[model samples]
Target chain A: MKFEIIDYKDTRSGFGEGLLELGAENPKVVALIADLTGSLKMDAFAKKYPDRFFQVGIAEANMMGMAAGLTIGGYIPFTGTFANFSTARVYDQIRQSIAYSRKNVKICASHAGITLGEDGATHQTLEDIGLMKLLPRMTVINPCDFNQTKQATKAIAKHKGPVYLRFGRPKVPNFCPPDCEFTIGKAIQMTEGKDVTIFATGHLVYPALEAARILEKEGIQAEVINIHTIKPLDADAVINSVKKTSCVVTAEEHSIYGGLGDSIAQLLSRELPTPIEYIAVNDVFGQSGKPDKLMKHYGLDAPHIAEAAKKAIQRKA
Target chain B: MPEISELQAIASQVRRDIIRMVHGAQSGHPGGSLGCADLMTALYFEIMDHDAKTFDPDAINRDLFILSNGHISPALYSSLARNEYFPVSELATFRKIHSRLQGHPATKEKLPGIRIATGSLGQGLSVSIGIAQAKKLNKDEKIVFCLMGDGELEEGQVWEAAMYAGANNVDNLVALVDYNKKQIDGSIDDVLPLGDLRKKFEAFGWSVTEMNGNDMHEVVSHLKQVKSQTHKGQAQIILMHTEMGMGVDFMMGTHHWHGVPPNDEQAEAALAQLEETLGDY
Candidate 1:
């Protein structure tokens, strides 16, 4: 199936829209922001539901704990902040108060990966997915576009437990269907092929579809699948796809160590061993640059994914 | 409400449980557990309005307590079991493998009373503030209480939560500090002085009060006064001054018994000092 771009939008706007919808639908839904309401596009939710919204004012740790506390009274709290502060900054707070205690919190993080641009390495978070996925009860999700992020945001409210919903800063192509069903831990196959499978997540998913197009020109029919959920990964989808394709290329806007690539590698090594090449940041910190430049610099664009797919296909015996 | 004498008897028995639970486990914090025994007993037996039988995590319309300094799980577990949240027999399983009584208070094992996991300090105040806000949102006029150690104030997150609660007027929270003046390494002043706790909490916009945590009557009355003061514009905090180990003479006056379990002889001596009022769980 061919995927088309619907528009261009920042994924955080999708989260804000979804949160506003949740405020209308579920009275139990509350939002907490650590002083990044504008950046996270949470202004609408904050403005609409003043009573339910809490402006935590640059205290990420307090925001996480408060989110957990809100859950005890049957309130579903959605905390907003940069991906870095959301994960690494208040890791212990999330670990003890949320994940270990099994609090139903939606940790909605914006400005993920080097795509955060201009703000440099400190604001950018390339390790959030790894940090959150390591926690016992955390459900990690990196949605591809605006629509998918909005859908994922609404979906996780119904999901009981801690969730890390990661989204990007730049105005990437909003290609995901607005009405498409977004089941957590379910993979969406964008295209079909028999030679190799290109698995991607977050901002890199659109590039994976582009990579499939690039590979198709070279007589390489690449199957592109969007693995939105990192933890509790869609193993059945992954196994079934690799069984047909035999070779795999995993792509993400994160470090190759603990991101989607590592998750896929662990799964394949245990269940179905296959030749795989990773298209991700190679264990290095990001720098200040444009989102497109960073994607190309870190070798995370379509051409790089296509090249990785070729390498994986060649390795298949 | 239980009489002040009855509360004192329960406190004495709770002290015994803290001592014996630590001795039975051979590994638990005894000093703080012993130090906060009266306050825990007073809250469970006389101060808070809670049901011991049906444990609900939401705790809607009921007073909730969070043990922030979770190292004193023995004290919390004993208070909980003695209050009939669980069978008093489970007190013996403190910190044992496959036991609901974890080394720190946790909701993981489905323990009846615990609503959250708290071992790492300075996080509980923020959690309590959150729950307090939730109660306000639900229009459930219940109060939320959080207990923290004096040394736990050193964590930056505590001050952060303090600032939020004070600024937001989370009026339904009563945070109690077990100001025993001792920690693992040494006295709180020697380790990391919490410099004028009342002034600091006041600066963060809290209404500060002080009480003798080891005095059962004082604990009961002071907590009752604090509860009455809730929803009157500011979050409440009680700087409860307590001895490191109140009943056990050898354990008192030092930080040595902060986390050390007593030997058989020491346990016998400690148990002999307090009468077994609640039948020695």
Candidate 2:
């Protein structure tokens, strides 16, 4: 149960790195940023592939529609912006043009959740996963670290449908293997235990693993699984793990109402009934704070996940 | 070129199809549909250099038209059908369940001519600009045309698109606003007046053209003139002037008919005005 923190890396940089790689590999790949190229770490891709990059200056709704239309000409368009601006701000733009039309547009959203920090509630988005996952034909991915975010970003490009890849701004623990293999709609098991299952996504995934190791010392075994791809969720993988554990805890940096917990609850309630505890922000807006402090204040850190895991295990009848 | 009378004949039939389709479905926007009949008839029939024989949804090197104001699906469906995108008989399934011609334009049904699902108002311009940019990227010499409703300008997304199209030099796109000044709620002036549309478009850096959209010859000539003006680093917009219900005598000049379907007697009366030129579906 020992692991080394490889380094701290912002997830948006991973997305930018993946976009640059995609530019070299696929000629049909094009990118559009809503005047946040530097913030999204997309300057390299924009500079390297000038012909493929479109700077749509601060107009996110237009960016979404343009991305949808790019698919009409057989081009894969990856749109970049903050999570709040990406989803809620342009929900109809994405819904009608991209999701409903089944356009091959990758909506890459960074600065997700309260981890966007000092920008306050307006900039942070805790309901984007809920917004995106409800759309039909939308693949929602929330990778844990830089490596996984980059891998997820690259993975969505090859997928011929609408995808929402959520990442963050802070440079947290980048512990995932540098060359990790990423598959869409598949859950990656970080730890195997039987007392309780901790299903986590996005930035909270790293904390779930840390919670698992801490719980091991207390003679409690927590099965930690990273449910990166939320929609078309790895239902079989989830059902299998819950069957063995018989109790579950879902963690995310999103609202407890409709993020990973809702998706997993729907999965377990229909397939196999299990007691579940949620490690997410209650229905409320975020405030200005440091990223780490925000996670602690919102009770989304490792200690919160560990406590939730224990509560879930105790609730199992 | 097809005779102007021939185009007018097709428009006459298209107007018949518009009311009949709406009357058959028991719901639809007939006013704008009838108004744009002439413009779309010319675009699909003679102006566009598109091959109607083979329908490839992903074909390049062909002029494309998108109905942004999707409630006018009747006009787009009739035009696409008569131009050989699909069977004219399918027009009967306008808003029926399991019909490809949904109330709005969509690509999910894999409808031949529709490249993107529009009608969410204010979104089509941005999408057209995307295709125009794609045409530029591929070095493909084809123009992208989008039709919008005058009332839809109230949505901020349209202006966002308008701003993007001009600033990005999306010259390969030509957008047309159906200036019937009618929406579902009421007349655009009574509801939300769009003060000086041409000036607004000009301020957004678009090369604006004002024409009588209901006139077949003006529609054709303006489309051709705009095609020549593309790629000059300025997007073009045609602020078309037409009556709310252009072809129908009783329905013109009022916003009341914007969305209301005609009853049996009214349908008969409306059909009496539009001659059955190309035969009914």
On lDDT, the candidate that comes out on top is 1
User: What number of clashing residue pairs does each candidate have, in the order they appear?
Assistant: 0, 0
Question: In candidate 2, what are the lDDT values of residues B1-281, reduced to their tens digit?
Answer: 89989999999999999999999999999999999999999999988878867765655888888788998989989999998788999999999999998988888568888878888889998888888888888898888899999999999989989998887778889999999888888888899999999999999999999999988888888888888998788999999988888888999988888889999999999999999999899
Instruction: List TM-score (chain A only) for every prediction.
Output: 0.99, 0.99
Please give, for residues A1-317, the per-residue lDDT of candidate 1 as tens digits: 46799899999999999999999999999999999999999999888999999999989999999999999999999999999999999999999999999999999999999999999998888899999999999999999999999999999999999999999899999998897778999999999999999999999999999999999999999999999999889999999999999999999999988999999999999999999999989988999998899889999999999999999999999
Model 2 DockQ (Cα-based): 0.79
TM-score per model for chain B alone?
0.98, 0.97
Taking all chains together, each candidate's TM-score versus the true structure is: 0.99, 0.99
Q: Which pairs clash inside model 2?
A: none
The segments of candidate 1 whose C-alpha lies over 4 angstroms from its true place after superposition are none
CAPRI grade of model 2: medium
DockQ of each: 0.92, 0.79
Q: Model 2 over residues A29-130: C-alpha lDDT tens digits? A: 999999999999999998999999999888999999888878777899999999999999999999999999988999999999999999899999999999
TM-score of model 2 (CA atoms): 0.99
